[model samples]
Each structure stands twice: as structure tokens, then as C-alpha cells.
Target: MSLNWITLRVRDLEASLNFYHDILGLPIERRFESRGKQIVMLGTGAQPKLELIQTIDQTLKPECGVSVGFEVKSLDEAIEYLKSRGIPVLRGPITPNPHLRFFYILDPDGFEVQLAEHS
Candidate 1:
């Protein structure tokens, strides 16, 4: 089957929105409140690539060993932009090969986000 949207249970919807939408520039496809819960879908086109769900409990911890990766045009530029916004890079701009490079950063909810570039 084709891959569908990936969901993240976030502690703060507004903060997540700011990070993913305002900072990363992911457009909001749609958002709605249902059964006292907030859900927002974000992506570039008709189908949402990422979905953020508001957790009922703010103290719920995120699961470990999970990361979402985004392919970037330039790893250096991405790191610079993130640094300018005070977002810390948690790991390397490691080059496993001449054509590939990547780094990690934590989202507002402590989710590991990998930014990678491939030539």
C-alpha cells in the first residue's frame, strides 16, 4: 500500500503549529476540533504528509527511538536557519557518503527530526 500521513501526538498544538508551520513552512491543509480534541493536518499539497494530534494529557511522554526525516536542499543552510531561530541541532551533519549528509534536531515535543541532503 502507498504511504499515508504520519501522526504525532503533541503536547502543545500552538507551539507545534509554530514550529512546523511558521518555522518549517509546512502549510496547513486543514484543522478541526473534534470531541474536545484538536487535530491539524499539514503538507504542501492536497494530501497531508504530517498530522498533529493534541493529546488529552499534557504530561504524556513521547515514545523513544522514533524520528521523522525531511530531505533538505542544503544541510548547511538548514542548520544555519534552525540555529538562527534558536533551535538546537542534537546530532551530526554526518556524511556517510559523498552524496549524503544529515543531522538531527528535536521538535517542540521532543521528537527527533532528521534533516538530510543528498546530491
Candidate 2:
């Protein structure tokens, strides 16, 4: 079976939207408000969508251990783009093997996001 979607509970919806949609350039597929909660779905093509939900009175801290990874066409280009945007890279641009390169960056809530390229 294919994966459906990944949901993340965000503390500040607007800031999260700016980070994901504006900075990272994930398009918003849809958004809705329900039960005093605001939710937004962002993604494109056939990949799994990312859902951001903001609930009233929610105060959950981001877990550092969990990480979401995205594949890129060029690791160097991706790293340059993030650096140009003033986004800090938390980890390596090291090659795990001759075929792969990766780096990590923290999201707005301090969630680890990995970008990798494979040859």
C-alpha cells in the first residue's frame, strides 16, 4: 500500500505556512477550518502530501528524533538555495556513499528535515 499523508501539528499556522509554502515553495492544495482548528494540505504531483494542523490550546513540543526526508535532483543546488535564503544547515553535506549526499535543516518548529541527492 502507498502512504497517504503526513500530519504535523503546528503552534503558529501563519509562520508555518510562510516557511512551508513561501520559503520551501510547497503549494497549498487545500485548507479548511473545523472544530476550532485550522488545517492546510501542501504538496504536488504523486508524492505524499504534508498536512499542517493548528488546534486551539495545543502546546506540543517538536520531537528532535523524528525526521522527514525529500529527494533532490542536486544536493549542491538544494544546499545553495537554502543557504541563499538564510536557512541554516544543521548537519552534513557529506557523502554517505559514492551514490548519495545529504544534509539536514530544522523546520520552523525545530523538526528535522533532510534533503538528499542520489546519483
Candidate 3:
């Protein structure tokens, strides 16, 4: 079976939308409400997408070990852009190899997000 979507229970819907859509440039595929939860799907028309769910209770503690990664055109450029927007890099521009580099940042709801570039 193929991966369809990864869901994140967020505390603030608007903040999450700003981070994913405005900051990261992910397009909002759709948004709707279900079972009293506001849900939003983001990314291109692809199988593996991001789903943000905002419930009435905004008590969410995101796991430190769980992080979602996205590929970037340039790691340095991404870092610069994030810095310009006042988003601090949580981790390094770690290079596992000569062709790959990545870094981590915390989302508005404290979820870790990794931005990487493969040269």
C-alpha cells in the first residue's frame, strides 16, 4: 500500500495554515469541517499529502521525535528565507553526504519541520 496522507492535530488552524501555505509555499488543496474538527489538506495533487486537523480543544503536545521533511530547491536559500521571516533554525544544515544537506525548524505549534536539498 502507498502512503496517502499524514495528519497533524494542530492547536491553531490559521497559524498552521500560515506556516504551511504562506511560509512553506504548500498549496491548500482543500478545507472542510468534519465531526466538529476543521480539517485542511495541503500539497500538490499527490498521494502523500499533509492534513491539518483543528479540534475544539487546543491541547496538543507534538512529539519531539516526529518531524516531517520537505525537499527544497536550495538549502541555503531556504535558510535565508526562513531567517528573513524570523523563523529560527532548530538544528543544523547537516550534511550526511556531499550531495545532501538539511536543517530543522519548529512550527508554530511546536512540530519539527525539516527542509532539505539534494544536489
Candidate 4:
């Protein structure tokens, strides 16, 4: 079976949207309100989408040991883009081998995001 999507609980829907949709450049595929929660799915509709959910009655905190990863064509360009936006790299540019390089950064709600380049 193939993966469909991954969901993240966010404190502010607009902030999350700004990061994922505007900054990361994911296109919003679908968005709607459901049972007092706002949900948005962003992706190209070819691969698995990233889902963001926000609710008013609950305070959401990102959990440890979980992160979402995306592949980049150039690790240097990705790093420069993030730096231009004032987002600091939390860890890495680590190379496990000659064919791969990666790094981590925190999303708006402080969830780790990994950007990797594979050669």
C-alpha cells in the first residue's frame, strides 16, 4: 500500500499556511471546515499530500521524535532560500554518504522539517 497523506495539528492555521503554502511552495489542493476544525491539504496531487488541521478548543503542541521530510533538488539552494527568509537550520547539512545531504529546520509551530538532496 502507498501512503496518502500526513497530518499536523497546528495552533494557528494562517501561520501554518504561510509556511507550508507560501514559503515551502506547496499548492493548496483542498481546504474546508469540518466539525469546528479547519483542514487544508497541500501538494501537487501526484504524491502524498501534507494536511494541516486547526481547532479552537484545543492548544496544540508539537511532539518530540516526529518530523516531516521533503526532498530538494539542491541542498545549497534550499539552505539559501531558508536563510533569506530568516529561518534557521536546526541541525545538519549532514552527509551520511556521497550521494545524499540533508538538514533540519523547525516549522512555525516548532515541528522539525527535514530537507534533503539526493544525488
- Cα-based TM-score, every candidate: 0.92, 0.90, 0.94, 0.94
Backbone collision count in every prediction? 0, 0, 0, 0
The sequence of per-residue lDDT tens digits that candidate 1 reaches over residues 18-119 is 999998888998899989889998997645389999996777665567788888998999999999999989999899999999999988999988999999
lDDT of 2 by residue, 39-113 (tens): 999999888999999855456767747777888998889889999988989999879899999999988877788
Which residue runs of candidate 2 sit more than 4 Å off their true CA positions?
56-59
Residue pairs with clashing backbones, model 1:
none
Which lDDT tens digits does candidate 3 get at residues 1-119? 88999998888899999999999999999999998889999989755889999855666777747789999998999999999999999999999999999999999889999999998
Q: Which should have the higher TM-score, number 1 or number 3?
A: 3
True lDDT of residue 76, candidate 1: 96
lDDT of 4 by residue, 60-84 (tens): 6676677999999999999999999
Model 3 bad stretches (over 4 Å): none
- Predicted structure with the largest TM-score when compared to the true one: 3
Candidate 2 or 1, higher TM-score: 1
Question: How many Å off is the CA of 65 in candidate 1?
Answer: 1.7
Q: Rate the local accuracy (lDDT) of all candidates.
A: 0.89, 0.87, 0.91, 0.91
Give the C-alpha lDDT of model 3.
Answer: 0.91
